[model samples]
Target: MLYAIAAVILSYLLGSVSFSIMAAKLVKGIDIRQHGSGNAGATNTLRVLGKGPGIIVFLLDIGKGIAAVLLGAALSGQSDWVPVLCGLAAIVGHNWPIWYRFKGGKGVATTVGVMATLAFIPALIAGIITILVIAITRYVSLGSLVFAVLTPIILVIMEASLPILLVSLILGIFSFIRHRTNIVKLWQGQENKLGAKKGQ
Candidate 1:
């Protein structure tokens, strides 16, 4: 129990390290959350800082999620549920990073990392579908939503562990909640595309 608690706390802290915000400050002398779409995420990073910095932030955020799950597994002696819980904790922290005054990204990239680690085949399939959606529609938010909504169904079909399935469900709900504004904009045909200029 003590180990699990420590793992959760450590994972949260790891996720709280927003690479987008740090990269923006370092490269552009500005807060990423105040620019582009005012979102501390890869899409906004791409808009505000260009491809290099955006990709860096995306990879770093994914690394945070992967690290959290691995760390939880290690600290919890490879317990079945601890890693899943820690992964969820990391996603939550990504969405509301403590270091960033509880303001942070949408957790799509982090969710990708967590789900990939938890269930590789299902995640890979879902990811392929998501990329296809983005390629066809150029709507990153829609791709993200599709990934979030489909991952759990894939997991259930693959007969994943209860804890993992539950975490995926919660993560899906969190994704939808975080993307509420994007959903509205998409419905109104006002959402930005993948390569649109900043402040679009």
Candidate 2:
């Protein structure tokens, strides 16, 4: 029990490290949240900065998710729930990071990491379809929400463990909550496409 608790706390701390913010400040000496969509995530980084820094931050953020799950696996021994809970903690940290004044990104990239680690096959299937959605629609937020919704369905079809399914469902709820504004913009036909510049 103690190990599980420690893993979660450590995972949250790990997730709280915002690579996007670090990259922006290191490269351009700016607060990432003050620019573009005011999101401290990779997509916003790509928009406010460029492909170079954005891709790096994206990969690093994914790494953070992966690392947190592995840390849970290592610390919690044979417990299944520990890794799942740890993954959720990481996403929460990314969304409301303690280190960043509780203001952070939407946690999509982190979710990708956590899901991929917990259920690789389901995550892969949903991810492929999600990529297609983004490519065809040029709507990253829509694709993100799609991935969140599809993951648990795929898990149910595959007969995934209860903890995994529960985590996926919770992740989906978080995605919707985080993307509420984007959903509204999408409905109003005012959401920005993937490559759109600011105010476009």
Candidate 3:
């Protein structure tokens, strides 16, 4: 019981360290949450702060997820459910960070890191496919949607434990929810592309 509680709280804090918000504030003294689509994630970072900052935020966010999972596993050992629990903890943290008023990024990158650690091969393949699609379509939301939707399915196919699969599905659903605004913009043909705007 103590271990579980500690893991959960630790994971959430890890996730809540919104690197995008921090990067924006540090690099330009602006709140990432106050601009672009008002999202504290990579896409919005790209939209409001340009590519360099966006890339940095993306990597850092992914790093947080990876760090949390690695830490949980390292501390808890290769116990059956600790990895899954820690992964969930990281996702929850990113979605509702304590450090940032409980508002955080959409959890796509972090989720990727989570699965990649637990299910390395499948996550790698999914990540490759996702990146290809994003590169071709210039739609981060679509790529993320692909990542989210495919992750649990892949986990299931890989024969991960039912518990892991269940948690992964929940994480995927959360990713979709976070990307809701992006979905709207995608349909309306108003979503931002993955490059510098003209004259910028």
Q: Which ten residues in a row have the lowest lDDT in candidate 1?
A: 191-200
lDDT string, candidate 2, 20-65, tens digits: 8999899999998988888999999999899998899889889989
Q: Which scores greater on TM-score, model 1 or model 3?
A: 1
Model 1, residue 6: distance off in Å is 0.2
User: What shift in Å separates residue 16 of candidate 1 from its native position after superposition?
Assistant: 0.3
For candidate 1, write residues 1-200 as lDDT tens digits.
89999999999988888998999999999998888888898889988999999899889889888999998899888588999989998998999999989999999899999999989999999999999999999999999999998999999899999989999999999999999999999999998898987532
lDDT of model 2, residue 41: 94
Candidate order by TM-score, highest to lowest? Answer: 2, 1, 3
Whole-model lDDT per candidate: 0.91, 0.93, 0.80
Please give the ranking of all candidate structures by lDDT, highest first, separated by commas. Answer: 2, 1, 3
Superposed by TM-score, candidate 3 places the C-alpha of residue 166 at a distance from the truth, in angstroms, of 1.5
For model 1, what is the alpha-carbon lDDT of residue 83? 95
RMSD of 3: 2.6
Q: Of models 2 and 3, which has the larger lDDT?
A: 2
